[model samples]
Target: MTYKYILPIDTKNVSLEMIGGKGKSLARMASSRMSVPSGFYLTTSAYKDFVQKNNLQKDILNLAKPEIIGRTVSFESASKHIQELINGVELSDEIVNEIKQAYGALNGQNPAVAVRSSANAEDLPDLSFAGQQDTYLNVRGEEALITAIRDCWASLWTPRAISYRHQMGIKQEVVAMAVVVQIMVPSDVSGILFTANPVTGERSEIIVNSSFGLGEAVVGGQVTPDSYVVDRKTFTVKESIIGPKAQKIISSDKQGTILQDVSEHERSQSSLSDKSLKELTSIALNIEQTFEGVPQDIEWAISHGKLWMLQSRPITNLPPQPIEVSWEPTPPAKILARRQIVENIPDPVCPLFEELYLTKGLETPAKGQSRKSFFVGGGPMFVTV
Candidate 1:
């Protein structure tokens, strides 16, 4: 492939350093015959080159200053200048040719692609920079792709992104932006999937939130979606919550996106069948197994009755549980001790004394103990031999 970065299917077995967790997973999924959109990553190397060429270190240091004092910097001016600098910079002919070839391999000429940001710091176990950067959908032509790449790079410094970086304790200088350019799926239904129940932290269940048209409505929380909770082990739908979906976001005829209301009949119906839900759970479990992780937050799209995994990330907000230890070999009888005491105090109290004796029997003694005599109620009582 003569592309700056190869397609996910072509670049299998990439390490975390080559591409972050998210990119590596996408590439692996594509290679596994899973439904992943045709795409190419810009690679971390390209991000490094942009940083070195633009002297981004100085700019980042300046941006960090205001962050130290809990003050926000107006990114409008800085962002504008940095974007202009990046857009003005020309790509090497070799890199340009490589990108052209890669694009050509994906059905060539004027294919509409979605350019999204995938940074190394994003989609990690400790942090999830979800929706922090920008994504440009329906970008057409090679020239537009180049511009979109630059825009994606510039989006790393958007006001919300800058603020998020500060909040996350991420050093602006240490971060690099990788661009993911994928052929856009003409989605009829799209939304997010949680491999585990997000609300209750239950690992045996998978939760899905879906909406008609584009996924923006569900993602943006503009409309209530049809929610499904399926048992991961049995692949059975445990619960379903149908919402009154008044509107949906769909692709515009000209370009970009638009919102349209759902028909009265369609709004009442379930978007996915029980069989499809089971199939989706299987796909999600496969992804989870491939990553060898507890849970994953997945983005999915359905087009022409086929499901596609758009993105996958570790569920970062989930708290870690204590590790369970298994019992193997039984301990020696001497390791356990039993103690008994008798006192003719009261009939009702005798049961309490026996219970206390049994309770003390479970305790193990310290290494050193001295024999001592004690007097109880003017009566001699043996402490121990």
Candidate 2:
């Protein structure tokens, strides 16, 4: 069957295989009438076509094999060689024309856009693969956009990406890169919003991290952003901590991006207003619902007082749901404290271990053994095991 190499952002039937994880999510969001920026997906078919036409697949896979086996071929060497091979190839004229046509459809002449990598193996429920590739922001004109797209493709072979895929047991040959090209939002305020508290794992809390200028400062860990924790049920701000605004990233006139310092007056102020926070929270909740109630890590921006959804993915490594377990000590144990051995055992003991050790071994003595002089039981306040 033949598939088009390009698809409009709102194409509802786009699958993870066709457009990769981020592209599929963006398409879904756009179709659902979320405030997503206008964009198009350069589908994985395009990437495969490029690779096949250039005959780089075999060489690339051969280079990747060393990382999985115990071969001496260093990750840096393999990544560098593979990326250079991809970057040196020329994209087909058909692909170039399609990209140009799509770019022209956006508003204005040479509109700046963000070109992001969307890999088939990324943004999964169990494997996040976050920040494993490249995202070129504020790319303008056909040449720059095309370069950014090629760079995004090459980023699939970055050292970290190669090592991560190997560690996760993901076959390198099965992975393909799709690109998300969206009109840049000249964000005066940008940040990330989590539907659930990533740190505390509280499903009832929404965490917002905001900063001035583009979101790169916050997303790239260039600055400590203003943090606000909002109660999900009541939609009220629980805690707001203002960060030192410091420096921010913005687009350069010639091309690419540059950093600038925030004025002293604005440095001490919150990046988002109260009303904006409420609106962001509501939108985040709706997005969570749209994804079948899976907690989301959403990237958002405010341009000219309007909010835009940049990206959303299932929050990875989220802590288990909070429960209402009482802290009172159980039988024989008067108080629970972290002694030497307890300190060594950091995490809570699994149920199986507790049952075998604390219940059977300590409390009920095995077979012919007599009743223990002291019984051991678990308490929520301490790690007894």
Across 112-162, the per-residue lDDT of candidate 2 in tens digits comes to: 999999999899999978898999999999999999999999999998899
Residues 158-233, model 1: lDDT tens digits: 7667667777788877777777888888788888899987777788889999888777678779999999989989
lDDT of each: 0.72, 0.88
Model 1 collision count:
2
Off by over 4 Å in 1: 1-10, 54-56, 67-81, 84-93, 319-385
Name the weakest run of 10 consecutive residues (lDDT summed) in model 1.
Answer: 373-382
Tell me the TM-score of model 1.
0.76
Clashing pairs in 1: 2-98, 3-98
The candidate that achieves the highest TM-score relative to the unseen native structure: 2
Q: What TM-score should be assigned to candidate 2?
A: 0.84
TM-score of each model, paired residue for residue: 0.76, 0.84
